[model samples]
Target: MLIWLFLAMNFIITEVVKGIKHLYNEEVAESLISIQDTRKEFEGQATIVVFPIVRFSKKSPEQTANDLGAYLVDNLKEVTAFNVVKGFLNLSIANDYWLDLFNNSLLQPDFGVIPSNGRKVMVEYSSPNTNKPLHLGHVRNNLLGYSVSELLKADGAEVYKVNLVNDRGIHICKSMLAWQKWGNGETPESSGLKGDHLVGKYYVIFDKEYKKEIEALKAEGQTEDEAKKNAPLIKAAQAMLLAWEAGDEAVIDLWKTMNGWVYEGFAISYKNLGVDFDKFYYESNTYLLGKDTVEEGLAKGVFFKKEDGSVWIDLTADGLDQKLVLRADGTSVYITQDLGTAQMKYDDFKMNESIYVVGNEQDYHFKVLFLILDKLGKSWAKGLYHLSYGMVDLPSGKMKSREGTVVDADDLIAEMVATAKQKTEALGKVDHFSEEERETLYYNIGMGALKYFLLKVEPKKRLLFDPAESIDFQGNTGPFIQYTHARIKSLLLKADYTPGVFIDNQVALSETELDMIILLAKYPSEISAAAKTFSPASLANYIYEVAKMFNKFYHEIPPIVKEEDEQLKRLRLSLSDVTAGILKSGMRILGIEVPERM
Candidate 1:
């Protein structure tokens, strides 16, 4: 989202700088001039801090503000009146300015959206492993990555959304091996289970049986770590990984079949969750990518090979320990695949920035990855970022995929929709909706509840998600903002509002009405801030505030739809119209949908 600021704030700041130059014969940077919303106790729509300008004025603070106030009201038509309080200058903007914004803002389809700024970026998110279905942890990851991409687009950056599926390695081989050993052929159709869930079931089975082997070995007097290393199941899974990589036909066929099932399962889960990817890079295809690069790094002395033949990079002087890039057995590690994948993505898109939306668990991993790339003299390494977010905790506690205790993404989506159905029916508004309409409404409300709840929090914070608490129709929840959008739509429908209708400047205004226009003006800035921080929570909270303000304006005035004066009624209707536009545009980028009714 782009926060191309409104005219008044920019205009005021520019004029204030000019005023300072003329009055004090001084040079001032525009950034030093602070313009903000007026305090409730003050008598203006906007407030300017006079203290920053005091050094330019030879007079006392109050006197300096008074002189500036006189200059502004006399010279600028937008400044209708002004008052001085201590060192602050409160300027009441003329109604013409407010009325013009309400009138013209609706003319453009993309009201607060900024045009393209020619910056190309790639956001990698929802990078799931084929060994298991996505879980609550994946939920937060997907929502954050998708929304951040949308936010960057709104800020006028050309963005590509990509996903990296961990389809190879020992983890996947474990699931494949367990399925083969335990099952007499259990396909997704045969078991009536989602493909990913079916595979995930075998993964848990592998862990359970693997644990038994470890415990039995431990009982034979070996240490715990020694038992783990000697476990037969682990060795078999490792062998399977080697075979699959070596292109053994039987292992390769099984890998393809199982990975296919998981992909089918992942598609349904992603659609239900309202997230997607433009391109997918599998670890299997890119696992060998960084080998040549490693050789190049070795020749350049960026990498060192120890006596055992493992390639490594020394970074202790850079405040980090040495990191291994390749094993002595000539196999790539996890970071090796990442190093190659990063290079391939850059080679494909050549984006200005490549943001990795992974959990904080990989913070050190990315720091090393980017630093290694930089040491290898890749120019794009400078633009690499790790958008590290904290984990999402449930009331039950942290989830474990190997224990089969994680909440499946598909199941959670169904539960949210079901919860939405129950709450919406209890609320009694959806009784008139059709079966299909009711289902669609339920999904929108439910997913809106889920996405908004996850996106509204600062991405770096570990959030405890309460599904029931998030579905409420009031408070700062998703349903509240969704409902507010519906309310504005209902109001616009009743008033028969037409876009681009002229709003008279002479109409009498209430503080709440003007307060809404002022609040609406902040939408552009909100987008800019959200994009800069790579945090959807900033935009999420701003929309909630706008919704709250709209509701206050709605309830405070009785029958705005049927006021005695035509001009006042039209202005209110237009205000409602613009509010609805802002709410819809804001929520859309967060991967949420707001219904026109209910």
Candidate 2:
């Protein structure tokens, strides 16, 4: 619509330049046109800057603005009036235009969703290892990835959500070896522990024992590195990795059993997190995938072999150090697996874009991976993106998985829900609800608060998760927004809102009312900007502002149910209805559920 107005203004200005001014230079006329949103102090809807055209008119900025403003007012029905401020020609849109925009938006079921643009995008997130239960870090990863995928979908791109499980490697072997050596047939069912937690316990146990052995070896006069390498437990875990790689049935069976437990645990956590993936890729299946790709790269001379038979890619030319693609023993390294996975993903979806939602620690890793693929002449490599996000910390400081100090995702979620229940009960807001309804509401608010708190921050910045701060009902928090939605819903219900009632054009709108209409009109553009930047923070903050504006309007404007005039009541009710719709729509994109009753 803004573009349409710009085109309309351009045509009118071009005509004015050719006929009224007798200056037919197309370049001068084109350069003179600039349309933008009116400044807050300006009494208009849109502003046309006339400073650029003053030279063409050989007139003062104010006079040139006045001339252009007169032409626009006479030509465009939407431009009912205009004012000149210095060089800015501020045009006031007629009240009917705002009403029509509201009505058009109300008629459309999916107001902010863009039409399909025929592009496929693959977003890989929640790349959790099978060694342990997901922690707060994984929570951030999943939320960011899921929200990004939804943003892309809202932008009309075909998106595929994927997860890559690190089910192989020495990390998995640590847990398996620990269980084999220490366990007397303990399982999740027997221990009454979550599967991932149960497996994680063994991993921690392995670390503790490995440290003890290393200390003992050091006490026996060996150097630190020698002690670490000679530690019996570490060596056993290393052997287990080799055995599993060699397809040893016993090692493979143990690996599957333990990984199965972790998978089951992960499934529950993902469900609780309200995140899902269309597919899952396993390192066990993909570890050898890149070996063939390496051979191909070597054949193409994209990678060179050293005397020790190790294949390397000299990315120094690309401003990165030379990276090892394959070891001297002909074993595939991390980059090898990544190369194979990239090709496999491309082969699977042929996505126009493939986004890896990884921690910033792996920024260099992705740079090398993408460069290697690009050097291999893969066309889709250019579309690969590393959505590197900063780590999530707690007020308690950093977490260490080996030390068993990380805040587990399941536990954090449970705590959040509990916190919600406590906060809601303290406020005495759920006195009339049943236990089931209360539980559902608590879940929605808890998860909503959790997700919104994480997503409101820019992805590249490290965040401190403060549970109490996030669940507040009176600030820039999720519950505050959720409460506003509930408030609007309650107001609408009390008024018995009836759809399709036309607001009278003669009706006067208060400043707050007009401001809200303008804000509501910006929703589609906000979503587009959010999608384009791959940042939910934009939409999150926009919705917060909308909620804030609505709250102010609720306090300042006349009560909708008590408005004396029928037209006024209908208009106020329409405003409330549209505000609620946009609030719900925006929160949905952030993977939040706005409850009908808080």
- Best candidate according to TM-score: 1
TM-score to true structure, per model: 0.96, 0.94
lDDT of 1 by residue, 342-456 (tens): 9899999999999999999999999999999999999999989999999988777887665556777888888888998998999898777888988999999999988989899
Q: List the residue pairs that clash in candidate 1.
A: 1-151, 1-154, 1-155, 3-524
Candidate 2: how many backbone clashes? Answer: 0
Candidate 1 accuracy as lDDT: 0.88
> Candidate 1: lDDT of 148?
96
Model 1: residues with Cα > 4 Å off, grouped in runs: 1-7, 402-404
